[model samples]
Target: MSGSSKKPMRRAVVPVSKTLPTDPQDQHSSSEEVDPIFFTPSPSPPSNTPTPDNASALPCDHATGEPHRHPNPTRHPDFWFHDGSIILQVESKLFKIHQTILANHSEVFAGLFDVPPPLPTGTTEGDDMVLEGCRIVVLHGDTEKDFESLLRAVYNPSYFDDTLPPSADVETLLDFISGILHLSTKYLIRNLRQRCINLFTSKFPATFDEYTAKSTPQPSYSSTRSSSHKQERYRSDTLMRALHLAHSCNITTSLPYLYYCTARLSLHRLLKPRPTDVDWQTKSVVLAGRERLRYATLAISYSFLLVFERAPTCAEMRCGFASGPGREWRSIVLGGESGIGSAPTPPTAATSITNAGGVNGISASATAERKSKSSSNRAPNPLRLYTRWPELGVCDRCVEWNKGVHERGRREVWERLPGMFELEGWDELRKAQGS
Candidate 1:
């Protein structure tokens, strides 16, 4: 009976009135403003005594009426945050930040917060006290802009989130990363510091070939490919900064690769004293890198010429190649002309081969000469030979042979790169980085 005959009861709804705060001018009535748990007021007025005109005063110091204390001059214009509760005045600029957040990320800050209260005389057991306000701290010696950059990274949620915002520009991105690394090192934030190093390494690879490989074409199966898919190339300054940062931070794994790329810069740029603080590439490293490259270049040049000299005489049936006179390969590189000068040639046919005895001697002499040349030019770069081989008027068989040599030479150079720079092999570097 209850199921069949009972009518459903309807709940009544009540409407409540909403009003603004008592003051009509109060626009922030709906949201609560964050207030500090503790506040330390400024000190009492100073007595009328002649203060020095150049006496430095803290930014937060508001002592009214003295021997006329000058107003504290402003220093950092870019980092002044109106809403920051803890005022960290670095130079002339005041940086308002949350102490708990800073303490969470840095041991130095945590230690600062853990300090016991000052004595009645405004001294902390022989340590100098900061300004009157408990929240106002003074910093000296470090660049204010760098400190600002560190704060931005700490407060910005994008870096900590899974989705990172696109970097506005390479230089800006580099400065941000560098700032983070510098502060992280100072504060002992190992995880954050390592993350900055990783980002830098990913952009500026350790090997010359790896840097080139970043631009290598990727196969796209999609029907609709756009220009946006291509990334902008990093500038030369960015590379220099990466190298400098690597050296400053003791990132040994990135050194050889960075040195290789820097050596590729023109002699003038590489040899010049670093133009600015940011351009921190070490002169000594560049010198060593250049010396190694010079030796490699000379070896390659000699190898190319040796290969050209030892190639067999033309066989007419196999392929069409210029023969007889006026078809020799021209030298295009440094030391290419003097290449075979270092190589010894066998005695001429008229001077030696009088009969069977002379014939065998001539064959052995030629063999010895070729062996000496090959040994002298042991550091070969086959790729350079392949590029210049077309001008040599060689046959298809010879071209293919040179191509194989070029590929082998490239592989050898890459494998020996770490040793050339006097560092551990690539595998060891990667292992140390926990890659």
Candidate 2:
């Protein structure tokens, strides 16, 4: 639909001025020049201007008056034939679709049909308009596979189900939903866009409070591995694509969370060059998101330092594990025992902050307090000190006290995520819809 034209359809504006600059340099002195300013031709565009590298050349058949017939015009199995009366083509694939059904769901299609077909007087049939022998519309600027996904959704009454089918793999469902988003957006289908957004937001949720309350935290190694694998289930490239779609479609609610999830990936993984197509704008967003995440993680670390600094010290000798010194607990929180060496020795006088640890592996450890160094090589999380606190080595009173601190600290950081990342408030973000 979009193509370059040698001559613009709209008339070009030509200026007619009565006055001219009096300065010698600005004036044309030649008598034959007609005072120069009275009649000035517009400058021609530079002949050497580079064409966009990303722009695809239109098929030669298009200019030669040859109909670009599809090589594989066979209809898809599930979507091929039904009670449909209209035909739509996406490149090689031809789809039999119902006009009324699509018109009802999409304002764009409805508006298209609202225009009376160019028929002879008294020669028109009912409301449905058939062109030549059939109502055919050829779609450009999208892949057949994407259109098929959208048509499948548009035709099926139960496509936007509240629950996913048991046979559906979560990742596959997400990809299809993303496809719906792409096509729906291109076609101006609001209902399908909203459905896709709702489903995607639910799948990759922003907060873990609802989930964490029910499931107990696993040990560090297993928890970290599980979180990594879960992230792997949906490839990073897919998430990046969805993020680009959200921005293009004005799906603001998904932006903050998508950005955060993308930022969570390690630099090596995030920076890995992929063959997949990505626009420059989306790539810029990802780079900026990395910086935003760093700032937020640093802020959370500072919060941990502040909380640990003010915590009441246990002077009683009966206090187990932590009886060595009040400062010992602070050391453990800042990775003093984790062998990261980033934390200040005297945690109370700490002036700098460190990186936040893994997302799902937050925990505390009293055994870590006793150990000269951590056994694992993972970066330490301040909240983990309280969540996975070695209860075996800690006194009952200290364990209970640590539990309250851990919960409060983790929740505080969670609440601060938006502010830390410079995103809109969580509540407002959740309510946003695609335009």
Candidate 3:
């Protein structure tokens, strides 16, 4: 039945005290303490009958020999179907959903339903319980929000619609997906698990080329209002949560890029992580990887510039000279950290020749103009490929040679990314994903 067409139902609540035994294979065992669900036959008395002064002394169900009710809260507004065969309690919320729907999607639920309730011993209060004339199965470890997301996704086809508008709130989307992924994995719902994995991979692509292709230009960073700062904080927290989720779910392919992004966060931000931030071990790994990235930035990304080796085919004396445009370009790109004492002045139009189409097909004048405009504000992004080699005032041959060297360096860095973050190689990660 459509969720919209279903009216809410009020039912008696039964609090359960007994928790489920820990499943050796359950991923959530280490994180959440789950209680086992008990089932009992419906009580003989009508649910609406006035409670006796000593209601706690009520007799147990004759069939199962289990207590029938403990008043708490009403049924869930959306998921409580009058015809539902089973009642699931997640915290204070109660969902009267179908066993068939759950069994169709989850092997765990199917196996659960296959096992009939134990023969009642009549010794324990919670050995078996009932509510609203249906069996109550309490999910002890799960939160109402997460269980609600799972049911919503199951009952409504359009709940997790992917064709969201461009301006959809990213944080909300991620939260929804994360919650679904968690329960789906626990319940062994393969399709929903795969859907969540696909969404995560799209955001954090497994391949380097895809990652580069989707890379957004880094925004200019500056101090902002309290709201902006809060937004930044939320983004950081979300990133940390995503990293943890990827690890827990064995979404290995996304780890390197996630680690790389974590490495790029400022030291202050890293040091002052949220209380529920990625663990100390993860933080240490990121810090180590950040240092490696810094070394890679200078040693690989700008290797050609560091040595200032002119192309053998270069004819321009200005390109070949150690103190010429190459030195000035190095100073500009490296922020004068290449042993040049002070920040060298930008090359003037007189000193720089206007090549019609230089590096990456960008004209020398345009490159120079862009450089002049943003040079002061732009921070050096090590992973970014330098495409304005013509701004070095070097000849076409030297520019092409440097470009080739830079491209090779970037490819090497991509290959080494997993190692830098202490993760398995991409091939192994891909294999794990398939498995």
lDDT values of the candidates?
0.47, 0.47, 0.61
Better of 2 and 3 by TM-score: 3
TM-score of 3: 0.65
Best by lDDT: 3
Candidate 1 residue-wise lDDT at 188: 48
**Candidate 1 residue lDDT tens string, 1-435:** 667665332111211111111111221121323221121222322433222223223322322223212234353455445444455655445565667788888756665565444333232222222332334454533466768767766776466343233554556557667766766655545667777776666666665465445544555667465322354554556667776666554455676666666655555565555554233335565656555654554355334333343235445442332331012211212124223222233222122322312246667656545545544433222223234455545576666655565455555666666666566788766554331
User: Per-candidate TM vs. native?
Assistant: 0.52, 0.57, 0.65
**Candidate 2 per-residue C-alpha lDDT over 1-435 given as tens digits, one digit per residue, 9 for 90 to 100:** 345634332111222121211122221111122222111111121234221112111111222233434433445567655666555656766566677888888755664444333343212233222322334444545688888778878777686663466446547666667667766765567778777766666655456463243234444564535432222245677776666555545465556556655655555666576775344444556566555443333345334333432225554444432323334444443445522223323333222112122112222233333332442222323222233345224455555665665567556655655554455666765554424
Tell me which of candidates 2 and 3 scores higher on lDDT: 3
- Model 3, 373-414: lDDT tens digits are 444333334566665565566788887887888788877888
Model 2 RMSD, rounded to 1 decimal = 14.9
- Comparison by TM-score, 1 against 3, better one: 3
Local error of candidate 3 at residue 24 (angstroms): 15
